[model samples]
Target: MEKFAMKKTLIALAALAATTAFAQSTATISGSINVGIMNTGASGAQTEVASLGGGANAININVAEDLGGGLRGGFDSQIRFNAANGDRNSAGAVNALFHTANTYLTGGFGTARIGSIVEAGTCAFDPWGCTGGAALQAGTGISALGGAASVKQAVQYTTPTVNGFSANYTSSLSARTNERQTLGVNYANGPLALTAINIKGSGNSTTDGGTAITDTATSQRAIGASYDFGVARLSFLNTVNKGVGGATTADFTSIGATVPMGAYTLLAGFNKNDRATANFDTKISVGVNYALSKRTTLGADLFRSEELAAIAPRTGTAGSGFVTRIRHTF
Candidate 1:
């Protein structure tokens, strides 16, 4: 029965791609699934879990059509699933099959992207996000609680780079809950890149579940830069998250480097989260990857995190994590 179900899912995916690309000028299917053993907080005083946890697996389909006059249109859709059980990733109250979806148009006026789109301030420079290694926490310090990288009902625009500089803006076009807006500007030339991002959301005016609430404005502003030397690349990012309604604010700083060592590459990263509570948390990650081919790799990362400020209400703790996996891409 399990094999039958898996076969049906594959058939459905192929059919969907066919229908989407029936009349498009160009279409492609690209995705990867990494399967490996993962252990988190196994012997620590905190929680414990042992399962098949690797980087998120996805099936992506993209189609594009040239509309002439220096204009083009395309649509991209992605399905994220757990490699362990083949279950979809649930966000908010919905278990969406299409985790990432966007339709875009490009021309002389730059590019306009609509629908569920990538947030403006999320990882434009992170080598991990752009394909480096399989360190599950690739974007750990970028968003709140490692939330989704894309938002719904989002519309965004990117300006054409005149001299290696560009700007972009995005906003959730919804007013029912809270208004969210993001802005980013970046400069990239040669082996250097710099980016600044600001994300703000209007707070709620009413209370829910009998909790009184005030203030509807919260924000997270960050700046990041990176330089690549022939031997190794270094990057740094600092983020300040203004808590909800004058609560506790936090400043998160992350630094990472990727060094190429012949057929093997070394990756190291350090993250510090300083909260208004005076106590803080620090995490260090290091890993090495061996390239089996141009598109395949075998890698393992070791991570340890400690909290001086209580992770629980008033208790500080330490945790360890390890994952080794084989990742392939097309």
Candidate 2:
């Protein structure tokens, strides 16, 4: 009888341990669906949908394990699709089902993440939140150097906040000689936030035979700031891109403000890009958003642009456009 009771107790303890281990891990699915009707001088009126903060449909899978000693391991994957046609991507290199897949570890040492990850600090100063047709970062070509939205095969590290200041670094693991490196520093306290970012890489300038040339280094530097004062929030950003031999290729500046009134928020912004050879681009945007619920929003925006010197590609000509969108998060 003693032996039988001892064996049963051991089995019960093992069962409890297994249950505890399972309880320490968690998995969740969450994301958003955003769709809109857009009209532009370049691409007329059309139904469109895309991803987070960019009018796309996406599903996110997140899993986390509580590793003891105040450490945790996590995985995040985002699957973006076109709500209009159920396509992986309308047009881009990110045609795969999973455009964003990252593994991260967090503890007292801050956070370290690797894999194909979403680019950080892309929409810090855009009042439109980088959404729809009037998105400054997307349309005005402010973040053209790094392609604005995504980074692949990269490693990222972020430091813990110390006195409302933190630093982040990310580098691509591409085999190319001009692998990109990005460094950013951010600070936030009370209603004011500030950020500075630098991206450095060698241009893929090659000879006629496609031999890689590393003689010239190109870089982009940006500074952004925002302040919230109860009813209104205002933001500003300045970015400069330097080409080979350190010649300034593009200089972009933007300023925007948002005012909230109960469930309605109003936005307005203007931006300009001054490029080399007298080529320049400018835009003015205004919009409003209404909160249908905590998780749903309806918004509309109107924007006008002048693409002098054809700095960036526009639809037909520099003109005006509008977008109406509905978005829901879960």
Candidate 3:
């Protein structure tokens, strides 16, 4: 009789403890590995498969804790690696073990994150994320400006969506020469999303054994929009960069489209940069993607880039090449 009473008491205590929990926590691991061979430069090209962040190879660690009442805290860290050799990325290149790590908090109002965040102003009108061979970056005529691969030691905030409208702001705490402060506003309604952004930064050449000097400020203003029509989506982007030293005023434009057909996707985009004192260039790329599964993709692309006589890097350089790629995620 005494043992029976003790067992009942232990069960009651266990049930009470279960009902009094104040928070919940979760951790998830997700990553992708992309392998491809392509000629990304204008010179001699080689077919190598070890491209980290060249297209899509990344690992992400996400952890979150629910603090109840629609508030949560989390941390996110994404690292880039080469699939061929397993080397990590640093300084946008595969060198170290980690790349970007940040923390975030979400509440009824919105979500905010800091530490190595992505640039917010460059993807307003890109269908292919403004990257890869079939995106704006593959085009020569478009000189994309004021987009950081990732911001370090930064503080960022985003407002909750209200009727498909949201706002975002980011400022870097790093006291570098070209630290950026960015502001962006976004609106999404059904298949249409629009964006407006402003970027301001100041930097000058350092002299006398890394001594700081003053230089003119660089500013960028941009607006872009995209619409999806089920079968295909169209995108347009434009930007103006001012105070770029010798170039002075530079203007850029890009337009692209993506079409979905069963398990395949068609990608196309064009980019151009126009600066009076500099050389003119234009880039065009077309690609196709085959989705093997929800987390696996296979694709190929062909790019044709042209440059004028004045520029040293691409001057009188015109070439076309192809790349085949595969991506798998877990």
The TM-score leader among the candidates is: 2
> Once model 2 is optimally superposed onto the true structure by TM-score, how far is the C-alpha of residue 183 displaced, in angstroms?
0.6
RMSD of 1: 11.4
Clashes of 3: 7
Predict model 1's lDDT versus the native. Answer: 0.63
Give the per-residue lDDT digits (tens) of candidate 2, residues 211-251: 12242468888888999998999998888878967889889
CA displacement after TM-score superposition, residue 294 of candidate 3 (Å) = 1.5
TM-score: model 1 vs. ground truth: 0.78
Tens digits of per-residue lDDT, candidate 3, 185-303, equal: 88999999888888776432322211121234677777788999999999877777777553447577777799999999998878776763343457677888899999888888877
Question: How far in Å is the alpha carbon of 89 misplaced in model 3?
Answer: 1.8
Residue 235, model 3, lDDT: 85
Model 2 alpha-carbon drift over 4 Å, by segment: 1-19, 43-56, 90-94, 140-149, 202-217, 276-280, 308-317
lDDT of each: 0.63, 0.71, 0.67
At residue 44, what lDDT does model 1 achieve? Answer: 38
lDDT of 1 by residue, 1-330 (tens): 999999999999998887666545889998786655554432433322222222246678898887766788999887766665677742223556675689999889999999876665435444454322223224221222222245667798999997999998887787635566778888999999998888777421212111111225777777888999989998887877776675547677777788999989998777777773333367677878899998788777776655422445654455566657667776
Which portions of model 1 miss their true places by more than 4 Å? 1-24, 42-56, 90-92, 122-127, 130-148, 202-216, 246-248, 276-280, 307-314
Instruction: Give the higher-lDDT candidate: 1 or 3.
Output: 3
